[model samples]
Target: MQAVMKNVDCIIEVHDSRIPFSGRNSEFEYTIGGRPKILILNKADLADMSCRKQVVDKLKRDGCSRVLFSDCKHDSTNIIKKILPSIQELIHDAGRYHRAENRDYNVLVCGVPNVGKSSLTNAIRHKYLRAGKATQVGPTAGVTRSVLEKIRVCDEPLTYILDTPGVLAPNVRNVEVGMKLALCATLQDHLVGETIIADYLLYWMNRHRRFEYVEHFGLKEPTDNITELLVPIAIHSNKIQKIRTSEGRYEYKPNISQAARVVMAAFRTGKLGKFMLDDDALDSLSEPAVADNAGDARHRS
Candidate 1:
């Protein structure tokens, strides 16, 4: 990412809207230098809109001056409209240094995995160029393996976006942060285990008192036990499989893995409910010591 920073006119950091305050790589602020930066909180459609203003205000307080909530899956020109003007203004203010003086603008789209970087790239391409998808997009993390060549998104301003692989911090700060990232599918599920991820989701939901999962999964009540939760989900979804026992007899068993996937899918697709996984982190931003940790990691230097 550093190799291409000199060529980048602006940095567009994409993150899951549900985790606006967590899982961000603070190192990017230093890596990208002083180039203008914008935070694209993608998957806004799957986040609780009631806390939208609080999210924006907290981001601004934490020094993210340019933040836009976006849902790249749907054709919403709001993202394009907001981003283009900011890019134009930033580029105009900071004249091109190394490149030939030209109208074309190059933007670097970056974020941790599975936060919709490719989807955002395609959305911009379709909106501005009125063209088809220029990048591959998927629900799994790390879809884009490496830094890709710039793809034209707009013709008038001659804007092109460089889509980079979802780069995570070398070390996650804590378990809660890691679990939140996993819950949002920013990290691959298998790396953290599906059951553990689901357990974290259950704990988070219960802590927030968002018990929509109870009715959604037909559970009598919210229980902390993951096995109890998955059993009913498996039965309801008929996600059962036959396995050979030690006696060499086939036995039908509830597919716990399959059931966990179902629960996660519902959360990811907003079937359960929209949530802000970083809801607790927002309050921490107001504390002086905590607020200091919210900015660029190198800020400590």
Candidate 2:
């Protein structure tokens, strides 16, 4: 991150607004330190608007640098256009004053998993005439691999971009959370594994959602509680070779094996109703007051 920031005049931190906290790589903050940065909240369409409002408010109080909401999956070029000129100026100044070499300014695009970093890169690549380079193409045709990738959008008026992987934080618990992050590394297009886990939990939450959970599992009896219904399901599915509950009425064994299968299925499919693991309010940081000089130093000093 530090190298990218040092290489580029401006650093844009892209993140999924739905899971801001999850998407943020705390380490990057230390790497970039206080370099001129723009916080981009991507996938705004999937996130909660009220929460984003709060995050915007909060960002303002925390130095109010710059924040933009975007939907990379859709048309979000307007926001990029608004921020581009100032960013270009910052790069130009860096190349002219800060750097000793006659090279173009680099702009690093850093973000967490599935936040649309690649999509955003493509968007910017389309606009700028001198766009440096679109992610360095590897030897393999059509197959893409992640390795601190970079793209050149322009030549004479140079501006390079580095696309980073999803941020990984220690605070992130749950194996499912990790699996979701796996979307960054794996080639699979669907979040099948995450959905399987989610479907299981959702099954418990809403029994009606999955007919197999109750019908094929012999849980049709209205009197059967969650555990009771689960045991037979697990036994029938061969998840457990054998089943033996405690002999006494005082003891009851809840069925976890069945739940495990459900969880496993969620992971196999991205069926979990567009789950956003991160707190949405992280974007509520207030907008910083617009710079007074519209002509000068819009993003960097």
Candidate 3:
């Protein structure tokens, strides 16, 4: 998907604000290589607010001009206005250099599946066309290809809008890549390996955003970590009865889904504290497509 953008004069890279890092294509950096690019962090409503703040801070530190956190379903009049100047500048510069016969600017928008690229395009096109422009969002598991030839934007009749397929991590050849991808894709699920990740979360909350948790949950400082402090979550999960383990340890496995539900709810309700899972996390991951091309080119040469 990133390679395809090279043909365009400007590339708008879209990402889900909730899990920005996970959806990033490893090959994208190599493709853009610091070209004129716009980073759109879509689906902000589903994300943790603290995470959004951290992302905004990182982008500001990096001197990025275009950064927006918006849900696709809501009105985006302001965001559209913000993007207009940049897109116009790109088109203007390209037009100035082109001969009379060749005066078209291609603006390409690309992003991962379910990141709300289609909805964004519709919103953009509607604002430009001043009509009810409609675009369909495809399914998560499948790719939907559609072409709406030329969409007039700001009276620029030749701007072409292209919607591409979602890009997912290619199959890992070994455990190394698999593990790396897993770490990139999912947060440390405090529910899966309960005794382990729960402990980590507790430690993180206490050390980093201590005040919020204490005041909000009314939680007492634990002598240990989450595994040692199951009373609160256990009660929340309605685990009325606690039994002794076969080896003589207290066993409490609250409702299987309770922990996850709680964590997600707390995150939604502003209880888990503001956190960012994308920005720096995204900068740390491997750039996509670098591992294959160099070797193939050398062999061919």
Candidate 4:
């Protein structure tokens, strides 16, 4: 990436909008810094759009100048259009000493795993050049094995983008952060366990008073008990698994694991509802002094 950075004109760091702060590769600050960078929060359709202002403000204060919400899966999110103009504006205003003579734009699409880096790339490609998918899109992490060759997304000014493999942070120490990343499908479902992820989803929605899951999942009401949620779903959906006891006798039982996966799949596909996983962090923007004090303490420690 360092070698390719010389020819790259701008950087677009894509992240799951559901978690604007969680699981972001902090190493990007040192590796992809000093260039005109745009923080593209993809999966905007699943995010809390109301917190857009606060998230953008917080990112700008953290040194990122531009932050855009995008939903590559939907046709209405013409965020692809905003991207081209924004890229032109950001590049035109910044110094391009290495490639000053080049008229075409070369962008680098990078971010943590499964945050729609390839989807955004394909969206932009289709938006401008009316082309098909430039790269493979997957639900799990580490799908793109390497930095791909430049894919042309536009022709007017001749824009090309190098889609790189998603880079997760070296240390994800916070359990809550890991859960959020898992819920967003940045990590594989097996990594965090489907039941645990479903439980977290229920807990988050109940805490936030987002009870759309209740109606969607045929629950009588929102409950903290994951077993209570899964048992009914498993029976209704017939998610049963054949289990063999220690005596070697086979019996059919409600497959809560498969039920949990159903819940996860619904949430991922936005069937549960639009969820802003980082609402607590976004709300803190209203109290900068408290955040600054915590920052100070961390720095001091």
Could you estimate the TM-score for every candidate?
0.90, 0.55, 0.54, 0.91
Sorted by TM-score (best first), the order is: 4, 1, 2, 3
Worst 10 residues of 2 by lDDT: 136-145
Colliding pairs, model 4: none
Answer with 2 or 4, whichever has the higher lDDT. 4
Best by TM-score: 4
- Misplaced by over 4 Å in model 3 are 2-7, 16-26, 33-35, 43-77, 94-106, 112-119, 129-160, 168-203, 210-224, 227-253, 268-273, 277-301
lDDT of 4 by residue, 1-301 (tens): 8778888889998898888877777677787658899999988888768778888888788787889889888947677889988998889899787799998999998887888989899998988888898798987887888666589999988889999887545236598888998998888889889999999988888878889988998878789999999999999999988989999999999999899999999999989888778777765556556558777685465
Cα TM-score of candidate 1:
0.90
Per-residue error (Å), model 3, residue 209: 2.2
Segments in model 2 whose C-alpha atoms lie over 4 Å from true places: 1-5, 62-64, 89-97, 100-103, 130-133, 136-146, 154-156, 166-196, 199-301
Give Cα-based local distance difference scores for all models.
0.84, 0.54, 0.54, 0.85
Q: Write down the TM-score for model 4.
A: 0.91
The number of clashing residue pairs in model 2 is: 45
How many clashes show up per model? 0, 45, 7, 0
Listing every candidate in turn, what is its Cα RMSD in Å to the true structure after a full C-alpha superposition? Answer: 5.8, 12.1, 11.2, 4.4
Q: What 10-residue stretch in candidate 1 is worst by lDDT?
A: 290-299
The RMSD (Cα, Å) of candidate 2 is 12.1
Cand. 3 Cα-lDDT:
0.54
How do the residues 255-277 of candidate 2 rate in per-residue lDDT, one tens digit apiece? 46455555444422333333344
